[model samples]
Target: MSRLLVTGGAGFIGSNFVHHVMEHSDDEVVVLDKMTYAGNAASLEGLPESRFTFVRGDICDRELVDRLVSGVDAVVHFAAESHNDNSLANPEPFITTNLYGTFALLEAVRKHDVRYHHISTDEVYGDLELDDPEKFHETTPYKPSSPYSASKAGSDLLVRAWARSFGVRATLSNCSNNYGPRQHVEKFIPRQITNVIDGIRPKLYGQGLNVRDWIHVDDHNAAVLLILERGEIGQTYLIGANGEQDNKTVIEKILTLMGQPADAYDHVNDRPGHDMRYAIDASRLREELGWEPTYKDFDAGLAATVEWYRANEGWWRPQKAAVEAKYAAQGQ
Candidate 1:
């Protein structure tokens, strides 16, 4: 019965979290989202507006954030500029939204004295050396390279600082790559899925050897609920499904699930300064909070996701075309 304020609740993971919360608990959820390019209201279709409230606003608006944080028992902060390519093209929004937006949220929490949960990415830990590439723990030193990761790192530090300085109830979680239905086409998995379905090549970056720890969006949402309910204040938790796959390997798996072949896609130039790998040590989350994902294997999840996109063409067609048009215009 918690009154929860979920920032970015219209995006893929956030929308999934909202649905998860609605199904698993009786808590009242108020979703505050800017409804950016990646934030689609369709993701939350059929959700009742009575129990679930939606507010169109940016996290950087201190007054709006303060007003929204008021009367809410907790805040799950997820609003941000998440696309690395867009961040590379323009880092201003990432700085403003990720960094200052987090600051504003922290201030609101400090004033209201509510529980704050900061959602972050594994990129903040930077590239793992190929030789080891061992799982990243909570105390791992942050070595962000790109503007997006750097901004997330900045926000992470700000959250911890607020916990120490102002005694705010702040908890942060860094997660690996999430793949599931309703994901934006710009992300790797969805992009590949839509491309293959549309008779376009699934573009591979570099030799496609870069690895990422994968987690289903449902798993991520469940882990966040566990953290919000039972996690320690002033602590950080890493959430991953322990499903690690390299870029080419993931593409091949998706193709197999879709009855396609590796030859369906062509190798493309790698992005400059792309991190080779990102993994997370989720042991703390499991041992501390008893949070182990039901979807431990990505193969079945990927198959289901592929089937979903195949059946939901009307939902993704326009968005996919717009994304492809943007890339084509850029000569990418």
Candidate 2:
């Protein structure tokens, strides 16, 4: 069985990936997380002690990263300061964690010669116009608009450099928006879901015309595992489910599923530099790695996600007030 080191294992997508691996494979996982506000140790509770281990540490710590990389068979880099609004408010944390943090992990893996895979966002390719027929592809140029996307773009380059200059076995995948359980309420999908649950009106951003290519966390993680197992070294794959919907449609669906009127939500100010649309072209990943998404229906997957927040309010409750208050201060 393989032993994998998953950075950011206590956070949203990382935590879901950890659960996916535990349930679907025999591989053991050693999770290194800093317990950031977005990181929840409770999401990782109830795993088999023998197969799971959680380490509270920073990925920027080269010594600690080296010790962790020395033992694991592979390192899956998922740790990042991922909230765009926070990045706009303060960009330094994003630079330190996403860029320099990736450098530390690359150095460690290079020293130990371990398999590595870097997880990144499609925002590095920038936004598409509402009328454009194009979707982001493997060859898309980097045009990061926000501090968060810029940091990630820089990190992606670091992985490519390490693989070529040092011959470290590495692969990269850029995925579209992800929504599932254990996600922080600060995110778009969960915020609306929880807001409705608390008898609060759901808020939309500027006319809610922004479109996002949505994918379930399970689908995204499944593709990551596929690339790790069979993908060629130094290759990049794009993971998408073809689930594209505007903000208004998503909020309306959530309201309808929650037994409310479709127009029950309110519109608020949009975040600066908001992308108009983000679509992913996953032809390469499917043709090369034979990967396909199981959650093809956006509404069905979204309904299930809404139910998750409804049933697991205890898990998302503690952070709800703080998240809303932060948004309130920003007048978002």
Candidate 3:
């Protein structure tokens, strides 16, 4: 059985991945998380004590990272300053965590020659025009439009360089937008879902014309596992499920699903450098690694996600007011 080190495993997608591994594999997982505002300890609750261990620590801590890296057979690097709005407000954390943290992990893995997988975002490709018929491919050129994306783009490059320069055993995957349970209220899908749950009108950015290629968090995690197992080192895979929907349509769907009027949402100021659309072409991952997303129906996934928040009010309620307050302050 493999012993895996999962950085940011307490955060949304990382936590989902931890659970996925527990449920599907014999792998023992060590979760290294900073317990930041986005990382919730409760999300990792009820994991088997024998198979799961949570380490509250920073990825930027080279000593702690080295110690952890030495004990695991593989390192799945997921820690990052992920929120675009927050990155716009403060870019320093993005640089520290996404860039420096990755460098630290790369150094540790290079020293030990451990198998490593880097988790990244499709935002590194910037955005495609709304009418553009193309999607982001593995060979797409980097054109990040925001601080968060730029920092992630920098981290991706670091992994590539480490793999080539030092011969670190590593692979990378850039996934599209993810939506599922345990997501923080600050994220787009969860923000809208929890706002409706709390009797607040959902807020949309500008005309809400920007589109995101959505995938279930479970599907994204599944792809990560497949890449880590079957993928060749020094390669990058794009993970997506072809679930694209505009913001307005998504918010309206949430409203209608929650028994509110279809038009019961507000259009607010848009954030600076908001990308118009993000689409992914995962043909390489699918064709090469035999990976495919099970959550193909977008509406079905949304309904299930809405149901999760409705049933887990205590989980999301604690962060609702503060998240909405921050957005309100930005006039978003």
Candidate 4:
């Protein structure tokens, strides 16, 4: 069995990917996580100890990264300071973790000749006009609008440079918005879901016209596995399920599904420099790799997500107060 090292394994997408690996494969996994506010150790609960091992550390620690890279058959790099609001408040951590940390891992993997995959976001391509029919493809030009996206874009470039200059066997995937279980309450979907649970009005940004191309975390992870196993080295793939919905519609659906009035939510000030929309064109991944999303029905997937939050209040409640308090301070 291959031994895979998953950085940021305690965080939302990383933790979901770990679960995906365990459920679908015989591969052993080593999770290296820094346990930030978004990283919840409990998310990895009940995983078999024989197949899973957790390491508490930072990816920026070059010595530690070198040691870990030397042992793994491949490295799936997922560690990053990923929140746009948090990055706007303080861009330093995003630069440090997303850029410097990625540099450190790239160096280690290059030295060890380990296979690598970099997990990134489509925000790296900036936003599209609300009326535009074009979606972001693998060939989209980089035009990041926020510190978070800029840092991620920088990290993606590093992987490319390393793959070409040092012959590091690496692949990359830029995925659209993801929603599923174990997501931190600070994110859009979970924040609204948890607010409803606490008898508070869900807050919408601006007129709630900004669009996101949603994909289930499981579908994203499934595509990642396909890319890691069969994708050509040095190629970048875009992963999306074409589940596009405006902020208004998403919140309304959530309200309706949760037994509340569709217009029950409140409108708050939008974040500065908010992108109007993000859509992904994942044709390369689909046609070349033969990968398809199981969670293609957005409404059904979203309903399932709502049910997960309703039943797992204890998992998200502890982080709700602080997240809302932070948003309140920003007038968002």
Per-residue CA lDDT of model 1 for 1-332, tens digit only, reads 79999999999899999999999999999999999998998888888777899999999998999999997999999888998889989999999999999999999999999999999999999988767847799999999989999999999999999999999999999999999988988889989998988878888887999999999999999999999999999999999988889999999988878788766777877787899988889999999898888887789889889988888888787788789887777655
TM-scores across all candidates?
0.98, 0.99, 0.99, 0.99
lDDT for position 320 in model 2: 94
lDDT (C-alpha, whole model) for all candidates? 0.91, 0.96, 0.95, 0.95
Worst 10 residues of 3 by lDDT: 323-332
TM-score of 4: 0.99
User: Residue 236 CA error for candidate 3 (Å)?
Assistant: 0.4
Which lDDT tens digits does candidate 4 get at residues 154-240?
A: 999999999999899999999999999999999999999889989999999999999999999999999999999999999999999
- Alpha-carbon RMSD, each predicted model: 1.0, 0.6, 0.6, 0.6
Off by over 4 Å in 2: none
Over the stretch 1-332, how does candidate 2's per-residue lDDT look in tens digits? 99999999999999999999998899999999999999998899999999999999999999999999999999999999999999999999999999999999999999999999999999999999988999999999999999999999999999999999999999999999999899999999999999999999999999999999999999999999999899899999999999999999999999999999999988899999998999999999999889989899998899889989999989999999999998889887
lDDT score for residue 37 of model 4: 93
lDDT of 3 by residue, 117-214 (tens): 99999999999999999999999999999999999999999999999999999999999999999999999999998888778888999999999999
